[model samples]
Target: MKTITTAVAALFALSTAVAADEVCMNASEMQSSLIDWYGERPVEGPSANNTRLWVSDATGSWTLVRTTDEGKACVAAQGRNWNASMDASDVLSEIAENTES
Candidate 1:
Protein backbone atom coordinates (compact mmCIF):
# COMPACT_ATOMS: atom_id res chain seq x y z
CA MET A 1 0.00 0.00 0.00
CA LYS A 2 1.14 3.54 0.70
CA THR A 3 3.92 2.38 3.04
CA ILE A 4 5.24 -0.06 0.47
CA THR A 5 5.31 2.62 -2.23
CA THR A 6 7.25 5.00 -0.01
CA ALA A 7 9.70 2.30 0.93
CA VAL A 8 10.34 1.46 -2.70
CA ALA A 9 10.91 5.10 -3.57
CA ALA A 10 13.34 5.51 -0.71
CA LEU A 11 15.23 2.42 -1.78
CA PHE A 12 15.52 3.70 -5.31
CA ALA A 13 16.87 7.04 -4.18
CA LEU A 14 19.33 5.51 -1.77
CA SER A 15 20.64 3.08 -4.35
CA THR A 16 21.28 5.84 -6.88
CA ALA A 17 23.17 7.97 -4.37
CA VAL A 18 25.30 5.05 -3.28
CA ALA A 19 26.15 4.14 -6.84
CA ALA A 20 27.26 7.66 -7.64
CA ASP A 21 29.24 7.91 -4.43
CA GLU A 22 31.30 4.80 -5.35
CA VAL A 23 33.59 7.17 -7.22
CA CYS A 24 37.06 5.82 -7.97
CA MET A 25 39.53 8.05 -6.14
CA ASN A 26 42.52 6.94 -8.13
CA ALA A 27 43.30 8.44 -11.57
CA SER A 28 44.91 5.19 -12.69
CA GLU A 29 41.55 3.46 -12.31
CA MET A 30 40.09 5.64 -15.05
CA GLN A 31 42.04 4.14 -17.89
CA SER A 32 41.35 1.04 -20.02
CA SER A 33 42.87 -0.39 -23.17
CA LEU A 34 39.34 -1.18 -24.37
CA ILE A 35 38.40 2.47 -24.93
CA ASP A 36 40.12 5.58 -26.19
CA TRP A 37 40.69 8.96 -24.51
CA TYR A 38 40.80 12.22 -26.37
CA GLY A 39 41.99 15.77 -25.73
CA GLU A 40 38.74 17.26 -27.19
CA ARG A 41 40.55 20.02 -29.02
CA PRO A 42 38.14 22.88 -29.82
CA VAL A 43 39.16 25.57 -32.26
CA GLU A 44 37.14 28.34 -30.63
CA GLY A 45 36.13 29.26 -27.10
CA PRO A 46 38.15 27.63 -24.33
CA SER A 47 40.23 24.80 -25.70
CA ALA A 48 38.35 21.52 -25.79
CA ASN A 49 41.55 20.17 -24.37
CA ASN A 50 40.20 21.65 -21.17
CA THR A 51 37.36 19.17 -21.54
CA ARG A 52 37.72 15.41 -22.06
CA LEU A 53 35.44 12.81 -23.57
CA TRP A 54 36.18 9.33 -22.23
CA VAL A 55 34.06 6.67 -23.78
CA SER A 56 33.09 3.01 -23.29
CA ASP A 57 35.52 0.54 -21.77
CA ALA A 58 35.68 -3.25 -21.87
CA THR A 59 32.47 -4.63 -20.39
CA GLY A 60 32.03 -1.10 -18.91
CA SER A 61 32.02 -2.10 -15.28
CA TRP A 62 32.81 0.95 -13.04
CA THR A 63 33.82 4.69 -12.93
CA LEU A 64 36.15 7.75 -12.94
CA VAL A 65 35.91 11.07 -14.77
CA ARG A 66 37.17 14.67 -14.31
CA THR A 67 36.62 17.93 -16.18
CA THR A 68 37.93 21.46 -15.45
CA ASP A 69 35.54 23.63 -17.51
CA GLU A 70 33.35 24.46 -14.53
CA GLY A 71 29.87 23.10 -13.73
CA LYS A 72 30.48 19.67 -12.21
CA ALA A 73 31.80 16.21 -13.03
CA CYS A 74 30.45 12.77 -12.27
CA VAL A 75 32.36 9.48 -12.42
CA ALA A 76 31.72 8.21 -15.94
CA ALA A 77 33.76 5.06 -16.46
CA GLN A 78 36.48 3.19 -14.54
CA GLY A 79 39.27 0.83 -15.64
CA ARG A 80 43.02 0.22 -15.34
CA ASN A 81 45.20 3.38 -15.71
CA TRP A 82 45.70 4.60 -19.34
CA ASN A 83 45.96 8.35 -19.77
CA ALA A 84 47.77 11.57 -18.83
CA SER A 85 48.60 11.76 -15.14
CA MET A 86 48.61 14.38 -12.44
CA ASP A 87 48.67 14.32 -8.66
CA ALA A 88 46.65 11.30 -7.46
CA SER A 89 43.22 11.49 -5.76
CA ASP A 90 39.62 11.70 -6.92
CA VAL A 91 39.47 15.26 -8.25
CA LEU A 92 35.82 15.88 -7.47
CA SER A 93 35.81 14.16 -4.10
CA GLU A 94 38.98 15.98 -3.10
CA ILE A 95 37.35 19.26 -4.09
CA ALA A 96 34.31 18.45 -2.00
CA GLU A 97 36.37 17.40 0.99
CA ASN A 98 38.46 20.56 0.83
CA THR A 99 35.41 22.81 0.54
CA GLU A 100 33.62 21.12 3.43
CA SER A 101 36.64 21.38 5.70
Candidate 2:
Protein backbone atom coordinates (compact mmCIF):
# COMPACT_ATOMS: atom_id res chain seq x y z
CA MET A 1 0.00 0.00 0.00
CA LYS A 2 2.83 2.38 0.80
CA THR A 3 4.52 1.72 -2.52
CA ILE A 4 1.27 2.24 -4.40
CA THR A 5 0.70 5.55 -2.67
CA THR A 6 4.25 6.69 -3.44
CA ALA A 7 3.87 5.76 -7.10
CA VAL A 8 0.63 7.69 -7.38
CA ALA A 9 2.20 10.73 -5.82
CA ALA A 10 5.10 10.54 -8.23
CA LEU A 11 2.72 10.29 -11.16
CA PHE A 12 0.80 13.29 -9.96
CA ALA A 13 3.98 15.32 -9.62
CA LEU A 14 5.00 14.40 -13.14
CA SER A 15 1.61 15.39 -14.48
CA THR A 16 1.78 18.75 -12.73
CA ALA A 17 5.25 19.41 -14.08
CA VAL A 18 4.11 18.62 -17.62
CA ALA A 19 1.14 20.94 -17.35
CA ALA A 20 3.30 23.77 -16.04
CA ASP A 21 5.78 23.30 -18.85
CA GLU A 22 3.00 23.46 -21.42
CA VAL A 23 1.67 26.66 -19.93
CA CYS A 24 5.11 28.21 -20.00
CA MET A 25 5.58 27.24 -23.60
CA ASN A 26 2.23 28.71 -24.56
CA ALA A 27 3.08 31.94 -22.76
CA SER A 28 6.43 32.21 -24.46
CA GLU A 29 4.88 31.70 -27.86
CA MET A 30 2.30 34.33 -27.19
CA GLN A 31 4.99 36.78 -26.12
CA SER A 32 6.90 36.10 -29.29
CA SER A 33 3.85 36.73 -31.43
CA LEU A 34 3.16 40.01 -29.70
CA ILE A 35 6.74 41.17 -30.06
CA ASP A 36 6.74 40.36 -33.74
CA TRP A 37 3.61 42.40 -34.23
CA TYR A 38 4.85 45.42 -32.30
CA GLY A 39 8.54 45.38 -33.00
CA GLU A 40 10.12 48.85 -33.14
CA ARG A 41 6.72 50.41 -32.62
CA PRO A 42 6.26 53.01 -29.93
CA VAL A 43 3.60 52.11 -27.36
CA GLU A 44 2.86 55.75 -26.56
CA GLY A 45 2.92 59.25 -28.03
CA PRO A 46 1.06 60.66 -31.03
CA SER A 47 1.35 57.44 -33.02
CA ALA A 48 -0.57 55.59 -30.32
CA ASN A 49 -3.49 58.02 -30.24
CA ASN A 50 -5.97 55.80 -32.02
CA THR A 51 -4.77 52.41 -30.83
CA ARG A 52 -6.95 49.37 -30.09
CA LEU A 53 -6.41 45.95 -28.57
CA TRP A 54 -6.88 42.75 -30.50
CA VAL A 55 -7.10 39.25 -29.01
CA SER A 56 -7.03 36.07 -31.02
CA ASP A 57 -6.68 32.34 -30.40
CA ALA A 58 -6.11 31.39 -33.98
CA THR A 59 -3.42 28.82 -34.95
CA GLY A 60 -3.97 27.25 -31.55
CA SER A 61 -1.97 30.13 -30.16
CA TRP A 62 -3.15 32.97 -27.97
CA THR A 63 -2.04 36.45 -29.09
CA LEU A 64 -2.61 40.07 -28.10
CA VAL A 65 -2.18 42.98 -30.46
CA ARG A 66 -2.28 46.64 -29.54
CA THR A 67 -3.16 49.17 -32.16
CA THR A 68 -3.69 52.94 -31.29
CA ASP A 69 -4.08 54.71 -27.93
CA GLU A 70 -5.72 52.18 -25.64
CA GLY A 71 -3.78 49.35 -27.18
CA LYS A 72 -0.54 51.21 -26.65
CA ALA A 73 -1.49 51.86 -23.04
CA CYS A 74 -2.22 48.19 -22.35
CA VAL A 75 1.06 47.06 -23.85
CA ALA A 76 3.00 49.69 -21.99
CA ALA A 77 1.38 48.82 -18.67
CA GLN A 78 1.36 45.02 -18.95
CA GLY A 79 4.48 44.38 -21.00
CA ARG A 80 4.82 41.04 -22.84
CA ASN A 81 2.60 38.93 -20.61
CA TRP A 82 -0.48 40.49 -22.15
CA ASN A 83 -3.00 37.85 -23.16
CA ALA A 84 -6.66 36.83 -23.06
CA SER A 85 -6.41 36.25 -19.33
CA MET A 86 -5.42 39.84 -18.60
CA ASP A 87 -7.80 42.70 -17.88
CA ALA A 88 -6.79 45.08 -20.65
CA SER A 89 -8.93 47.90 -19.34
CA ASP A 90 -7.12 47.79 -16.05
CA VAL A 91 -3.86 48.00 -17.85
CA LEU A 92 -5.14 51.04 -19.69
CA SER A 93 -5.85 52.68 -16.36
CA GLU A 94 -2.31 52.10 -15.27
CA ILE A 95 -1.08 53.61 -18.47
CA ALA A 96 -3.21 56.62 -17.85
CA GLU A 97 -1.68 57.06 -14.43
CA ASN A 98 1.78 56.65 -15.81
CA THR A 99 1.15 59.23 -18.48
CA GLU A 100 -0.23 61.70 -15.98
CA SER A 101 2.92 61.49 -13.93
Candidate 3:
Protein backbone atom coordinates (compact mmCIF):
# COMPACT_ATOMS: atom_id res chain seq x y z
CA MET A 1 0.00 0.00 0.00
CA LYS A 2 2.80 2.36 0.84
CA THR A 3 4.56 1.61 -2.42
CA ILE A 4 1.34 2.22 -4.35
CA THR A 5 0.89 5.57 -2.66
CA THR A 6 4.44 6.57 -3.47
CA ALA A 7 3.99 5.61 -7.09
CA VAL A 8 0.79 7.57 -7.30
CA ALA A 9 2.47 10.62 -5.80
CA ALA A 10 5.30 10.45 -8.30
CA LEU A 11 2.89 10.09 -11.17
CA PHE A 12 0.94 13.08 -9.97
CA ALA A 13 4.08 15.19 -9.74
CA LEU A 14 5.16 14.23 -13.24
CA SER A 15 1.75 15.02 -14.65
CA THR A 16 1.81 18.42 -12.97
CA ALA A 17 5.20 19.20 -14.46
CA VAL A 18 4.02 18.21 -17.90
CA ALA A 19 0.97 20.40 -17.54
CA ALA A 20 3.10 23.36 -16.53
CA ASP A 21 5.40 22.89 -19.51
CA GLU A 22 2.41 22.77 -21.87
CA VAL A 23 0.77 25.85 -20.35
CA CYS A 24 0.68 27.66 -23.72
CA MET A 25 1.99 29.65 -26.70
CA ASN A 26 5.46 29.65 -28.15
CA ALA A 27 7.35 32.97 -28.70
CA SER A 28 6.66 33.27 -32.41
CA GLU A 29 2.97 32.54 -31.96
CA MET A 30 2.79 35.15 -29.25
CA GLN A 31 4.45 37.78 -31.40
CA SER A 32 2.18 36.96 -34.31
CA SER A 33 -0.97 37.22 -32.26
CA LEU A 34 0.07 40.57 -30.86
CA ILE A 35 0.77 41.83 -34.33
CA ASP A 36 -2.61 40.62 -35.56
CA TRP A 37 -4.46 42.10 -32.63
CA TYR A 38 -2.71 45.45 -32.89
CA GLY A 39 -3.48 45.74 -36.61
CA GLU A 40 -1.80 48.78 -38.16
CA ARG A 41 -0.87 50.35 -34.81
CA PRO A 42 2.76 50.89 -33.97
CA VAL A 43 3.79 48.76 -31.01
CA GLU A 44 5.08 51.20 -28.44
CA GLY A 45 3.64 53.41 -25.70
CA PRO A 46 -0.01 54.11 -24.99
CA SER A 47 -0.47 57.49 -26.52
CA ALA A 48 -3.67 59.50 -27.05
CA ASN A 49 -3.66 58.44 -30.67
CA ASN A 50 -2.53 54.89 -29.89
CA THR A 51 -4.29 52.27 -27.83
CA ARG A 52 -2.18 49.88 -25.79
CA LEU A 53 -3.27 46.36 -25.06
CA TRP A 54 -1.07 44.91 -22.35
CA VAL A 55 -0.97 41.24 -21.43
CA SER A 56 0.99 39.04 -18.99
CA ASP A 57 1.74 35.34 -18.50
CA ALA A 58 4.01 32.84 -16.73
CA THR A 59 7.08 34.02 -18.65
CA GLY A 60 6.58 37.79 -19.03
CA SER A 61 4.35 40.44 -20.59
CA TRP A 62 3.73 42.28 -23.89
CA THR A 63 1.81 45.24 -25.18
CA LEU A 64 -0.17 45.73 -28.42
CA VAL A 65 -0.71 49.27 -29.48
CA ARG A 66 -3.59 50.43 -31.68
CA THR A 67 -3.15 53.37 -34.03
CA THR A 68 -6.53 55.03 -33.62
CA ASP A 69 -7.63 56.82 -30.49
CA GLU A 70 -11.05 55.25 -30.91
CA GLY A 71 -9.51 51.81 -30.61
CA LYS A 72 -7.52 52.84 -27.58
CA ALA A 73 -10.61 54.33 -26.00
CA CYS A 74 -12.50 51.09 -26.60
CA VAL A 75 -9.90 48.94 -24.88
CA ALA A 76 -9.57 51.42 -22.02
CA ALA A 77 -13.30 51.28 -21.57
CA GLN A 78 -13.15 47.47 -21.31
CA GLY A 79 -10.69 47.85 -18.38
CA ARG A 80 -8.69 44.68 -18.69
CA ASN A 81 -6.36 43.85 -15.82
CA TRP A 82 -2.87 43.20 -17.25
CA ASN A 83 -0.98 42.07 -14.17
CA ALA A 84 0.29 38.48 -14.32
CA SER A 85 3.84 37.18 -13.89
CA MET A 86 3.58 34.63 -16.66
CA ASP A 87 3.52 35.40 -20.37
CA ALA A 88 -0.09 36.39 -20.98
CA SER A 89 0.80 37.06 -24.59
CA ASP A 90 1.61 33.39 -24.99
CA VAL A 91 -1.58 32.34 -23.26
CA LEU A 92 -3.68 34.62 -25.44
CA SER A 93 -1.93 33.46 -28.55
CA GLU A 94 -2.61 29.88 -27.58
CA ILE A 95 -6.23 30.66 -26.92
CA ALA A 96 -6.58 32.41 -30.24
CA GLU A 97 -4.99 29.56 -32.11
CA ASN A 98 -7.12 27.02 -30.33
CA THR A 99 -10.33 28.88 -30.93
CA GLU A 100 -9.58 29.74 -34.51
CA SER A 101 -8.34 26.33 -35.47
Which regions of candidate 3 are displaced past 4 Å? 1-32, 35-47, 69-101
* TM-score of model 3 vs. true structure: 0.22
The candidates, ranked best first by TM-score, are 2, 1, 3
lDDT of all predictions: 0.32, 0.34, 0.35
Q: What is the lDDT of residue 56 in candidate 3?
A: 39
lDDT of 2: 0.34
Candidate 1 TM-score to native: 0.23
Span of ten consecutive residues with least summed lDDT in model 2: 15-24
lDDT top scorer: 3
Give candidate 1 misplaced runs (Cα > 4 Å).
1-22, 33-51, 57-64, 67-101
- Residues 4-93 of candidate 3 have per-residue lDDT tens digits of 444333322322112223323443444466557632222235445343444433222334333442322222111122333223333333
Per-residue accuracy of model 2 over 1-101 as CA lDDT, tens digit each: 46544433332232211122222223334346555754422232232444333333232122223343222222322233333343445444434444453
Write one digit per residue (lDDT tens) for candidate 1, span 1-101. 46544433332232222244654433333333213343221111322333233422233222234433453444533333222321222322332343342
Q: Could you tell me the lDDT of residue 87 within candidate 2?
A: 46
